[model samples]
Target chain A: DAGITQSPRHKVTETGTPVTLRCHQTENHRYMYWYRQDPGHGLRLIHYSYGVKDTDKGEVSDGYSVSRSKTEDFLLTLESATSSQTSVYFCAIRPQRPSRGTGELFFGEGSRLTVL
Target chain B: AQTVTQSQPEMSVQEAETVTLSCTYDTSESDYYLFWYKQPPSRQMILVIRQEAYKQQNATENRFSVNFQKAAKSFSLKISDSQLGDAAMYFCAYWSQGGSEKLVFGKGTKLTVNP
Candidate 1:
């Protein structure tokens, strides 16, 4: 609904392989985030980009890296995929600034990744 | 860092009845926002309601309303006239006004509406 799209909606790869999940947004929002959902864990932030080339690590940023080369795209890469990394990844965008104290984020459908 | 807590792992309510989902957070910041998002089987996160910390009055959207107690740091969602379509996993999240850009979320509470 946020003009956000995720590539490889479903992926199945073997361990030790490299995987990248792409999140592209048409809205060109300033903020983009990567979150993974697992049973009993709800959702945890992996990484987020506030602007082009600006990225920050989240609580569970281990073994995961992100790159935002353009305003409309954010990429999440796993150098070496592991079975523990198998989870549903989500992409979300926040409009403008949060100083206004209000604004709900729009999220993409999600990308389900499985490691064999 | 702020953390959210959803004590109930799952809840059940009969059709046309009412149900409440409990959420609490630990934060030292006074200015912030709270949100409730619903994720159905389709896995799409839909905004159910939002509450602003500065506003004393509770926030409501149609049949969905939030009872926010800033002092107690408890935000509970009340659903009236629960329908089968209301069955989904609900998440409670928090965001600071001028601080943290991250929107921290709780584990989640799954709601089941029985016919």
Candidate 2:
């Protein structure tokens, strides 16, 4: 238990609507990541934040946007939700600082979303 | 670019037996870290084991151990005396120390422990 949690453990929405998933952490970790898991794709990174306001894109970042205005919160927004975006989203965190931590990432329970 | 490949999409083992999940990666960088994560039906991803590229000896944790072959670019996970609780989707991930803190994961291997 790394004090990581994702809101709305499950959600269902119609296509073309907007959706946002929230990731909250209590560890005050420096790095927070958003990933999506599918049948063939295990866990593909969507976006990640390094600090309070610094974020970067990952391999499968399209159709997704992230913001980290605070260290404890990382948000992933689907501007316009689509059928393809219906998948389980996971939030993960790790201390990127060398002396402060190892390379291991603690993950949240994951949020399952369905779009019709 | 870095990529991880798990050749076996599915595997099964009898309870109290041993099982090995294969993982191979492609990376030009020398310094990196590899990890295995287990996700059961609960959908929670838990870290199973980790192996650093610079470590010569294999890494092990209780029943979970890894065979690291740096030159061959292979990292495999071995579970000894598997239990029914070990049934889950096992994922192998790669992360370069010098690169972004992001992890590249393979498709994963679904493990079934039969009684």
Clashing pairs in 1: none
Give candidate 1 regions above 4 Å deviation: A97-103
lDDT at position A44, candidate 1: 99
lDDT top scorer:
1
lDDT string for model 1 (B44-113, tens) is: 9998999999999999999999999999999999999999999999999999986588899999999999
Q: How is the predicted docking of candidate 2 categorized under the CAPRI scheme?
A: high
lDDT (Cα, tens digit) per residue for candidate 2, span B1-115: 8899999999999999999999999999988999999999999898898888999999999999999999999999999999999999999999888767778999999999999
lDDT at residue B107 of model 2 (Cα atoms): 99
CA error at residue A16 for candidate 2, angstroms: 0.6
Best by TM-score: 1
State the fnat of model 1: 0.71
